[model samples]
Target: MRLIAPFLLLAALPAFAADPTPEITRPAGTPQANGVVHTLRQIPEACARIEGAFTGQAAEPYRFAVVRTSQNCQPRARFVDFDKAKPSEAAGWKFNDLIRVPSAACPSQQAVVRVWRKPVDVGQERDGQGQSRIYLDDAMKTAAAGKLPAIPMYAAAMSVEGKACP
Candidate 1:
């Protein structure tokens, strides 16, 4: 029985080594290395009021991404209201002059969202780690602005009037 116990322990050791998990390290502000990078400017009051309405609901889901220009990291923002945003119909478009904010009701005050470099799995570029995340907020006294920081979900984010919202 003693000899059997030692053999069983030795066999289990190999299983543990075979399934080693990769550790994820997240830092403040920008991510280290190839992780997600979110650049949030102070969210304006108008934009925050609009996004607050859809805090819980995923009605106006936006997408954002990071791009490189002249070797400088400059984040680009675009309208990605995929649900209502249609290519042909300007009314469905989030950035068009027709589409107005449900809260502000101002087309000019509307913002744009985007999705950054999404983590690829089993492809030319695969970051076995989980997806990168980002978030956006305003000067509201609400929870979405305070309680739990609403960071952007990995590669997706939104921008309006030059402010980035996760």
Candidate 2:
């Protein structure tokens, strides 16, 4: 009985210390992201296709994006509004860092999730509306919607149009 007590205690020890699983750690730039929430107005020409009641005749779609444009409204070189603005003073809106979203194309479409980012452009202009227009094409829209990587103002300019981004 001299050493039987110590031997029994060692045999009773559990294999894993009976502790919980450890959390998985990720890389620095990569982080868990929240869904993007904002009001999206379809371009007037494309509005009719999107059937829904919005503030204006244009349709409003609430979609998720990997990288969301900042909610803060940044002034475009101090324009009184969109009107009476000079083209030289126009600038693009800065968005949050890249993120993951459910889809990229249309709200009706079920596509693989994607990641994207929108680079700010201070020299791009569209529709002759100066600061009133922020333009993006299908591809750029894909990025803004979180389909691709961070794009420059030039590429993003092709994807989005109107004052939406700014």
Candidate 3:
């Protein structure tokens, strides 16, 4: 039968494959850095809203990281959005916050600077190569912001919001 129909279409092509990209597991005092030093501000009591570091989302399903002081803000250099953020405390190494952006749209500068961290990797969910391996756990449920796919498993990112307030 034509060589068993090409071995049954290559054994059913592994059941159609193509489904395995959902990860973000790395939270437990997450601080192992060859780089991690942050500073930036523009809170001005909220309305200014340009904090610095981490963005939003929390509970369990992780994704956190931010470093866009400028470049017009838009993926200018990249660090994407790590699946949408979650680990702030599912057990241990909780991170995710700061790097605010509002000031009407994008106009940073309340003063305070110190950026330099360039090694990232979280657990097991990489995409497109930019590098993302998220793996942190604990919350069980709560992190629900865009769901997932923003892509940004952390390995370095820490912030402090003080200077500008002076």
**Highest-TM-score candidate:** 1
Off by over 4 Å in 3: 1-68, 76-87, 91-93, 96-148, 153-166
Worst 10 residues of 2 by lDDT: 45-54
Residues 1-166, model 3: lDDT tens digits: 9999999999978855521222332222222121222333322211222223322212211222343444444431223232243233332322333232222111221112222222224344567986754444422232443334332233233332222211
Error of 2 at 2 (Å): 97
My TM-score estimates for the predictions, one after another, are: 0.18, 0.15, 0.16
Cα RMSD of predicted structure 1: 23.3
Q: Model 2, 1-166: lDDT tens per residue?
A: 9699988888867733532222222222222112333322112211211111111212332232222233453422211211232112124333212212222333222211111122334343455554545446865886788855332321111011122211
Query: In terms of lDDT, which candidate is stronger, 2 or 3?
Result: 3
TM-score of 2: 0.15
Sort by TM-score, best first: what order? Answer: 1, 3, 2
Write candidate 1's Cα lDDT for 82-106 as tens digits.
3343333223212111111221333
**RMSD, each candidate, Å?**
23.3, 21.4, 22.7
